[model samples]
Target: MSQLDAIYQLHPKRYRDKIEEESNYASIENQKQAVLSIGSLGVAICSLIIFLIPYSTTIRGVIAALALPIVYFSFPYIAISVAAERRRKEMERVLPDALLLISTNIKSGTSINRAFLASSREEFGPLEDELRTTAIEISGGKSVQEALDNLRKRVNSGLFQDTLKVLSDAIESGGNTAELLESSAEDIRTSLELREEVKSSIRMYTIFIVMAAVFGAPILFSITVYMAETTTQMWSQTDLSGEASSFASGGSTGLSFEQPDVNTDFLVQFSILALTITNFFASLIISQISNGNMKEGAKYIPFTVSISVGLFLAVKTLLGSFL
Candidate 1:
């Protein structure tokens, strides 16, 4: 067996099934091999970069090389999640319209199966595919409730699932299906509008957080660290032997000029680490405020970190040149 096949075989069945489900949502075929290829490429690039860094310690390189394999192996999963989220969002955007169309069909005396099939228009995107499948299942030997349950399971969206569950319950109770669908569509539209309003109201908070984490902290740390380093350098070059001797001779002014014990390298490393952590949490907070999901912020992590670090380096360089 090939290396990817070996890895896939070693992976747990549940995890493999989850990957397959996410892959289906992402419309990706043969995802196991794709994930393996992506992970291997990422690890190779990261390990090479770690090893090639100038003046990097052997221990650091070895540790990074060891850790990167595990970290980069998750990249494909992250990618799949992002793609699936895109699909979910597309379906969500068109859900209300689809439901309204289905309600219209139901009011015109069409069966639920036919209504769903008719609602599977091209503009509905992923929801179109799902509705068509559900209709097909209902037309076959499967019952309506079971087909709808399958539809809910196929979608990894809370809103979609909840809507389907309500529809299923209505079906079981023999309620007015057309009116129920119309009301559900109206509720979904109202919820989406409220979400937009909430986002608008919190726009300033998101801006403040992004600015502070990506711009303010980096600039401040760069200035303070550069000053500390400059102070250390200046103290190192100053002559303090005469001052020490005068103090030893019991001079009236007991003054001493000792070199600073601060390590500039440690300061720079700490600043970078602090900036990274700050940006990471800031991204999550922004995502939570805007999207209501912390994982949605993962896409912003790299962008925030890169911009903040780059700004920090630029500020440090500018200060060094000016001073």
Candidate 2:
């Protein structure tokens, strides 16, 4: 057995026999999880090493320390996040081709398996492999319906899931498979085009989001820089050094009886840092919410935090002359 296959066999499933009876996929799930575990750990360690290192109190060290934690923590997240994203995009890219193939074969009056395998042999991109997997499971004594359902779950794209659900319903109801395949394929193509149309229609908002991310903050940053510099300059001009200087005319030295004892430079820098962190998480949280799954974007939080901090610090450093 493959290492991944072996690992999957270790899991104690509540419906092991039922799953085994329905599909062979459950038999190898443990191995897949084992690979994921190892991959996440490996990514985390590599990121830590690359982003963090032996350091002095130099500015590089400060930046490295600030950046390292986010990168380190996000490494594992990257693996999973990228996987989900990849699966989703892959499904979309290959879906049309799969649909076309299935539709054509069904029109030619082939059995579902032959149609699927014939379609599999074509370059349907990522879906080709998935089709091949489904063929394998069907060959392994599982129904084509069971294998396809499992594939849909693994993909988890709402549209794909809906399509698979429709297929399942058709199978249950003993409907016309060819007609269903043609309709589903046409529906998918229509949905994609409609989505593109909607997106193109609202291209303005995308620009606004980009503007908010890039140009909007710099204007505020310039204002903050001006304020911090003005405050620091004003404070520096006050003579706070002479407790008993010649200017202490009445023994109650005027130098320190009124001046605020806070470093405006440090205050502004700290405030900026805090704001950067807050903004990163806020953006990530909102994106996740918009996508209809908060957990989907949870892994990306650290990466967002890291990049935000980097940008924040870079701005601060460029304006460090004010300090």
Give each prediction's root-mean-square deviation over alpha carbons. 2.6, 7.0
lDDT of 2 by residue, 162-266 (tens): 888888788778898777877888888898888768667666664564356444554466457666766667877877656446557766535543555566556
Write down the TM-score of every candidate: 0.89, 0.65
User: lDDT score of model 1?
Assistant: 0.87
Q: Whose TM-score is greatest here? A: 1
Give the alpha carbon lDDT tens digit for every residue of 48-89 in model 1: 756755445977677786778675656677778778888888
Runs of candidate 2 with Cα error greater than 4 angstroms are: 1-78, 201-203, 240-257, 268-272, 282-323
Q: Find the number of clashing residue pairs for candidate 2.
A: 5
**Each model's lDDT:** 0.87, 0.62
Write down the worst ten-residue block by lDDT for model 1: 47-56
